[model samples]
Target: MVLILIAMQFYSPTKNISPGNHTQIFIKETNPSPNLKALFETSCYDCHSNNTVYPWYNNIAPISYWIDSHVKDRKKNLNFSVWQNYSLDKKDHLLDEIEKMVVQAEMPLTEYTYLHGNSKITDKEVVEIIAWVKQTRIIYQLGKQPK
Candidate 1:
């Protein structure tokens, strides 16, 4: 049991780090709304952004590993931290997906919410996020790339 427990500790995940300044530049260029920015930072940034604010307990092995997996999966699906890198069409599609996920209450991952209770998405907040995502997508569709 002791050995097994020790082995489990090694399974913890590590936090993500920014790959480059390009992602920062991307966010600066896009200029998301204050509300949208707060929503993303609070709910999505940990996994989807280039800069992850790791909690102290994340230093543990098994938990850290799991968190790392979540972050990897999030980035694979849609990395808002690196948004500017995507083509306008791709970003628009991603925003549509974001709206869909938020509307369906399928975001911020349940496992995440269990620990970070405050990260839970409220229905009203979901509506706000979805609306913003749709608006952004429309902006993209209209050929209004963020300056």
Candidate 2:
């Protein structure tokens, strides 16, 4: 088991590091308030964005793979770094999902908060995020409507 573990360390998954300001377009387009932006950077950006601030344990084998898997899955679901690429309809749907996830406390996954306590989303933050998602959804929906 020890040798296997050691071998695993040699094959680390590719890190999700993007060059330049990947979130810039998302920030400008979404126009979230400063507080909301801070909340997002603190709680959601790690897995949901192109850039991830890896924890110390991420250097370990198997654990690195697990963390990388989670990050990939999250980015697959909703990558804020590529937000500007989504269609209006997709944006509206994602906003709806965000609101639902926040209200249900299904985001900032428990495992994430366990390791990074500061990443935990408080009840107040949930309310704020949900409200912002609803407001943002309206904008996306408006854009979807034909002139």
Candidate 3:
């Protein structure tokens, strides 16, 4: 059993960190205010960004797998790290989805906040994020050329 446990350490999932330019974050193109960037980085970047600053314990097994699964699931749902890949229409749609998710307190998955208390989005941060999303979506919508 000890050997099995030791070997399991080698099975840790790939870390999500990256050194590439943040071409994926579409909102960056809009030149978000500095405050907005800070808010997003603090409250949303861990699981949403391409570069995750993994915790030390993330090197452990089982726990690493679980964390990886959550990250993968979230990235599939809304990868802010790959935001630029989305079309304007898609961006607007995603913004709408974000607003709904924030309003309902479904974001920053509970399990995540249990460890990284800072990951929890406060009401003020929620309001700010939603407002920014709405503003950006309006820009995307208005910029759409007539079909």
Task: Find the candidate with the highest TM-score and give its number.
Answer: 2
TM-scores for every candidate against the unseen true structure:
0.79, 0.95, 0.87
Model 1 residue runs over 4 Å out of place are 1-14, 19-31, 144-147
lDDT of 1 by residue, 114-142 (tens): 87777888887887776677666777788
Could you tell me which residue pairs clash in candidate 1? 11-61, 12-61, 12-62, 12-64, 12-65, 13-64, 13-65
**Cand. 1 Cα-lDDT:** 0.75
Q: What does candidate 2 score in Cα RMSD to the true structure?
A: 1.1
Candidate 3 C-alpha lDDT tens digits along 1-147 = 889778889877888888975533565565566776776676677787787778889888878888888888778877777877888888888889888988898876677778888778789877887778777877899879686
Candidate 3 wrongly placed segments (more than 4 Å): 1-3, 23-25
TM-score, model 3 to reference: 0.87
TM-score of 1: 0.79
* Collision pairs in model 3: none
List the candidate 2 regions with Cα displacement exceeding 4 Å.
Answer: none
lDDT of 2 by residue, 1-147 (tens): 999999999989998888888799888988889988888888898999999989889999999999999999899999999898899989889889888887888888888888888888888888888788888888888887899
lDDT of each: 0.75, 0.88, 0.78
Better of 1 and 3 by lDDT: 3
